[model samples]
Target chain A: MASTLHDTPERNIPVQRISTTTPMSGVTSHPGLAAWSLGYREWLRFVRQRNRVIGAIGQPVIFWVFLSAGLQESFTAAGTSDVQFLEYFFPGTMMLIVLFTAIFTTISVIEDRREGFMQSVLVAPIPRFSLVAGKLAGGASLAMAQAVVFLALGLIWGMPFPALGLLAGMAFLLICAVALTGLGFILAWRMDSVQGFHAVMSVFLIPMWLLSGAFFPASNPWLAWVMAVNPMTYLMAGFRWLLYLGSEERIAAGTPGLAVSLLVSFAFCAVMFWASCRIAQARVRGDVRS
Target chain B: MRPSPAIVISNISFAYSARQALANLSLDVASGEIFALLGPNGSGKSTLFRLLATLIPLQQGEIDILSISVRTHAVEVRKRLGVVFQSPSVDAKLRVWENIRHQGWLYGLSGRELTTRGQELLAQLGLADRAHDSVETLSGGLRRRLELAKGMLHCPSILLMDEPSTGLDPAARYDFWTYLRQLRDEHGVTVLLTTHLLEEADHADRVAILSEGQIVACGAPEELRKEVGQESIVVHPIPDHAKQLAAGIAQRLNVQTRTIEDEIHVTADDATATIASLLEQFGPMVSELRLGKPTLEDVFVARTGHRFWNRPADGDSLDAKGRANRKGVRNG
Candidate 1:
């Protein structure tokens, strides 16, 4: 791997750092409770501000209403999928919300680098991944919270809820949340400016949002194949699968998509987790700069 | 020194793109001494500081902090290094106590120990009274203090401040320097800071002046002053008349003439002759003139080709305050 731009090749390299060989896991060096406190503090920082709290929950709720209304006519004209636009998209929008939330949370890394918060974290006697993975897990936890509120929104919208699978659906949602945030964290590591970061993430975010059945039910054979390749499609499929558990015919029809999407998303998370660690290590070796 | 250099750097060299930032720069902060890296902008002081704090990896040198290699043993290195960046880091919505506690958690502290240490650090930083207060409400100086406390919450071996005095008012700047002295006298924390203020170096056991991405000079403050000392004269001739005026003054005084900040600055053992010559010959065309002892700017100009604050080259990432972010990979 080429060292980052910060690494001046000809000079005596500092301690050679072999970074990111495996999926960089876990940032909390102090056990579960300690990690919670760290993450909880991060949560409290954003939550105590009532506007931020409302903003977090309100975004997806509003997206559901507006996008559902916009796509209602399309659903009526569609083939025998046997689902309303609102029902089909509830899970997709929830996934999109988690995806966006992860992006927003990860942007904090750029902000922290500007303010010196990152310097404070790096100086602490902890694992290097604490700087990123801790942020990832913390963002995931918050995404999970937002996901629950969104699912509750789905319940109120008259979508057929498979009562027994709600917990399982939530479990899958948390996994998606972790996976999304992990990728966001890795992207955050490479960008130094907010404007540049948002510009690049929007490229990924818009394409993924469009392809993952968030606004449309992803039915075109050619397009569905492409959507099948998008990792987020699995999250939507998994949520839909769980939501339709007691129903007949349409239940788990997308199981292969579900299995494939989830595996791909996990793979993305693994790759990103390792990428973040590599970037962090490169920074430590003076090869990369924030 | 009781706190021995919790950090040691030797022959550190860094660059931004094709330009070098730290050219064979080296320094040591005896544990507990408030070492200050002094220079004007583009002096590579921030790059040196970031390297010592482990913000940037040593590209062409070696750094050992409390016996831990910053490269291979970064985890151990981080355990001892604490950084207070030039910009704000604490989230505005987080309470002061919460920010401090979060830093402790990153260091693997928890429960009572985290809380107690957080409290103690807040108290030590004079932020105890505002522990529950939201960080956004704090003033610039207080926020910086909170940043310092947050950095030190882990009881780091070396505490670093990169232009920590930038945003403070005059009173706060003075008090801030005093508090640094107390950090050593009371807590025995090794301190290394970067500053643009000349008087700021008065407190340093030693000071290094960096310019154009190189350590141009380094020594005790008084020694540096004495070496670069002697009378200095600066002349501002009527629009675009510097060359004519410099030639006139140099010929009379038989000394070196330099142009800095659009003015003809002449330095010699005795500037009396130079000033007299300028007043006699060039004074007719001169618009402004001043004579004084060689300040840090003189010390810098005596070595580097420009004034201390004169930015000759873009060297690092710049914050809103004009401080560099020390991104040696590709700086300004």
Candidate 2:
């Protein structure tokens, strides 16, 4: 189909004569262009695919509404009386949006590898880190966009979205998005099939989300210990605190402090980003696992 | 002083697990030549193409492109080379212009320069009218042309393509070659491609025939054909009698003969004389006979003593005699 963007009436644009005589070493050497182009292409593809945009934002909203409605009467926390199930599930649903968007965006890596695009990119002159960074940045941006939409739903659910708290929440969500997308990139880079990738998400990602105190509070000592060590738990706590910022009643529920949440989320982002770059560099050096 | 060759691959070997894909393969492609790596399936031409394109690592030797070493100077080598893989590499969701634009950015071209270059390549490849169309909607031939345009977007001095005609129809293949020749003649870009089609290889300035991970023949098409013989005489004996007739012909005429399917092939300097005598000797036993000028296919058979088209299927066990013959062929 003809693209709506470039379908303007044809004009006689003078064709500039490209000089092929430039020495190989003297060609323009802007390495960052590769990363920008890759990120931009991903953004373009994501926006054009209407179903992807819908599913990333729609599925989580549906999940949050249905799951909270089903569990609202039976759910209770030991430390708080004012926190309802829907209010408690809000941040988790935002996280779910981030997770789905991240997973959906990074899944293209496997398809790219299969369709020969990855091979072409790999053989290009740009540094390997640029490719990894581009994918992580692209996936993270999409994840954050969807997360912001889910976050806006907090107002309709009667949770106050204070300005500073919303800013902090946005920053926190961005960090989480980058970390989750980078993690997905690492997994997708090594996987040969999307089916194998889905199996991994089911076995690893869903459990990580469940244990992050999203569905239930970490009140028991053993479950608290697990949540204390879970990186996502800190993100969930940070998100909840941001959502219920001005209310002391919800704050008394004892989510982790803001500083600790930001620190752990940043650390997780840095670690995942580094790991993704390492995997991409290994592939560049011909250590492809597949 | 002679100009340096465009590509020089020396003594490179590669294997997947224990099965060797390429072994001690060495060849030189002169600058501005249209070179073809010719082979049947699993003959390692594709593997060799990957090695030259730097898609795979060199295990045993060196490949130099325009005097730059592929192993040590891979980034520089990549800068000078453009590669078109056999599979479709264009993103289906992106427009043709966007596909080339992204490829240009990979080589550090951007802004006005990238846009103008993309337009120029689209014009050169006869895709200017469809530049805004989504790649998924294009035919296989147009997609392939878009791939070529993408590969050449950075103005690479040397272009490497793996089976560039794999999915193209006959007319499309002809058009593709026309563009390739234009690239070489007008811009002096060296073109290297791998193909199993004998006619495709015949169109190249030079052809390197690979068999069992080794080169069995390398030369211009006419030269390789001349080396095989001036003419090839194929005799069709009745069914179930080819092997006996081949053996009889070898014994009676003392010429090298090989049985392929239900026919016996004998290469001769004068096909008329050979056919006349064979018919006189065998008479009614000969079902049919044909004489034709030696083709690249004949050159392959002459060099490898096996038909190019009917390679034994993978995992088929070789009898002891076939094994020994293959070993002798390899050693010799």
Q: Against the true structure, whose DockQ is highest?
A: 2
Measured against the true structure, the TM-scores of the candidates, in listed sequence, are 0.79, 0.90
Across A1-290, the per-residue lDDT of candidate 1 in tens digits comes to: 22221232332211111112212112335534444655676587567767666777788788778987887766741443676677667777778778877887888777776655666666555555655566777888888888888877677766677777787777877777877877777777757788987887778876887777666755558887987777677666666665555563454233344466557656766777777767665453212233
Model 2 accuracy (lDDT, Cα): 0.79
List, residue by residue over B28-130, the lDDT tens digit for candidate 2: 9999989999987889988787777777778898999999999998888888889998887899999988899889888898888778778877876678999
Give the worst 10-residue stretch by lDDT in candidate 2 chain B.
B323-332
Scanning candidate 2 chain A in windows of ten residues, the lowest lDDT window is A1-10
lDDT of 2 by residue, A54-150 (tens): 8888888898889989988887655777567887787788888888888888899988888778888888988888998888888888888777777
Candidate 2: docking tier: acceptable
Best by lDDT: 2
Model 1, range B1-332, lDDT digits (tens) per residue?
33456667878889877877778766666776777787766668877777776666678988887777886777667666677878677877788887777776776766786777677666656677899998889998889888877766666657788888767655566556666666666566678888876656656777777776767777777777678646556676787877877877778668788887677777777666666665676656877666665555567777877766545453331211221211111101
